[model samples]
Target: MSKNRYSVGLIIVIVGIILLLGKLGVFGFVWGLFWPVFVLAPGLLLHFLYFNRVLPSAVLIPGGILVTCSILFFLCTIFGWSLMAYIWPGFIFAIAVGLYEFYTFDKYSPRGTLMAAVVLAILSGILFGVTILFTVGIYLIALVLIGVGAYIIFGKRRSW
Candidate 1:
């Protein structure tokens, strides 16, 4: 399928699932919220495979791995799993991405990549804090905004 067609179908499925889960209850809502990890990791790898000739692999790979790990951590926490083992790896992925972006800024779209990294770092902290504090309202807001930002920034269709 064309990239645009695939992206549109993905978006429609995601939105449909979210709406269905939201109508169910807290558990469904929570599950829907953390579902993106399963969506993103392969999506990133696929993007690398399909579009590398057009866009640098470095630009998308680290961000994809970090996002995938982070989302896995969140889902684990929701399932009452202790995230101690996963946390450090996720943090490392994030830091590696940040450092990579910093060091390679001049090689690509420096401003956009750096800004995205900074925002993701800040957001990772905010989401971790809000989750730990049991701040559901703030967590939901931060989560939604991050979700929207990710879709806009990374989705192949450029929904933004």
Candidate 2:
């Protein structure tokens, strides 16, 4: 009769059905694909609790981080794990997202929260650039050099 009981019952029934379907091969592809949702759901629940005023706004930080990490995890699952080498910057960006969310939502946020968020975002960008450069090898450097050369040739000259 209580909300908790109803929620538990619903969850049990849904899980039971899913297991049944899995045994029957009805969810062959979907069964394996959705495992990351388990990691993502808790993050979403935290955000929902924060919005509903059941939890403090501070929850946004971990919630954002978890959600971002879960998405990246899912990507790693779908793509090859080798992609993780280049995508590791996502972990830094996840923290940045969490910090930014906390800064935006917490009225009494710490003084350096915004600064920390900005720094983390910049660090994430730098890491991502470095990763791309490493992954792409000399091509990226050549492209940059060509762009610089084109700028020097065609860019407007300014008087100093």
Candidate 3:
């Protein structure tokens, strides 16, 4: 995949899927975000570490923190220590990375778009969570997903 491959149509499909899942509920949103962080993060980090020699420390640090917190949150939830797990903080970390890449778009080399996707995914999860509080959350999430998708497809700006 070239960095220049701007698949607006593919992005629309992804956004549509996200919105549809959002309509499902909080569980859906949580699951949607989990796959990216759990799967993508590791692969991306490994690629950078092995191919770029950029060192795994940067990605692994945050990755470890997020994973640890998530596990603890799950444990707490299972043990009845908390009403529900608040995983937004992990999303916040991902957003921070997104901001870094967004600001230094040129310096990020090949992975800039992927970093932005990380941010969008995290935001989508949070939106899904918030929507859970109200019955309309799903509709709101769908709208947000559509808006972001449009921005990504047409804006041409590095930051999504």
Candidate 4:
């Protein structure tokens, strides 16, 4: 019983069960609902590998991006593809998430990696803000700006 043999056996069993369930019409109402899981599974596998020390920490970046993209895809499938217009910044955010994960898990934190994450985060915020301003209206933007400004100016003055 080698590991590869066990893994192959498990996968075959799982597929057989799924096929049997499908034939039984158990997934009739949810036939297409979990399509994103296929995309997400690899990302999860990458994370699992990193956690288990099977893969280098650098893999977290692409893994995070894949996971985030899968969630965005799922959201679009459920809500509407039109939502992508406003949520496109999520792609940038995903990259930022990957960078942050790498920084967190890597033994030697490079300055450039952290800086890249910060830049990506800022870009994502700007894109999201522009999308909101255009789609929601200027009034909400004004309110948000005022609130953010207030927080920046006064938030640190308060002692927790």
| Residue 68 of model 3, lDDT score | 44
Clashes of each: 0, 0, 1, 0
Q: Order of all candidates by lDDT, from best down to worst? A: 2, 4, 1, 3
Writing each residue's lDDT as its tens digit, candidate 3 over 50-110 gives 3465653345434444444455455544555543334444445555554444334334445
Q: Give the per-residue lDDT digits (tens) of candidate 2, residues 1-160.
A: 6999999999999999989988988787675677789989999999999999999999999999999999998998899688899999999999999999999999899999999999999999999998898889699779899999999999999889
For all candidates in order, the CA lDDT equals 0.61, 0.92, 0.55, 0.91
**Cα displacement (Å) at residue 94, model 2:** 0.5
> Candidate 1: global Cα-lDDT?
0.61
Model 3 regions more than 4 Å off? 1-82, 85-106, 114-122, 125-129, 135-160
Q: Give TM per candidate.
A: 0.32, 0.71, 0.26, 0.68
Q: Which ten residues in a row have the lowest lDDT in candidate 3?
A: 56-65
TM-score winner between candidates 2 and 4: 2
Specify the highest-lDDT model's number: 2
**Model number with the top TM-score:** 2
CA-only RMSD, every prediction? 21.8, 8.3, 24.4, 10.6
Q: What would the C-alpha RMSD of candidate 1 be, to one decimal place?
A: 21.8
Which has the higher lDDT value, candidate number 2 or candidate number 4?
A: 2
C-alpha lDDT of candidate 3 relative to the true structure:
0.55
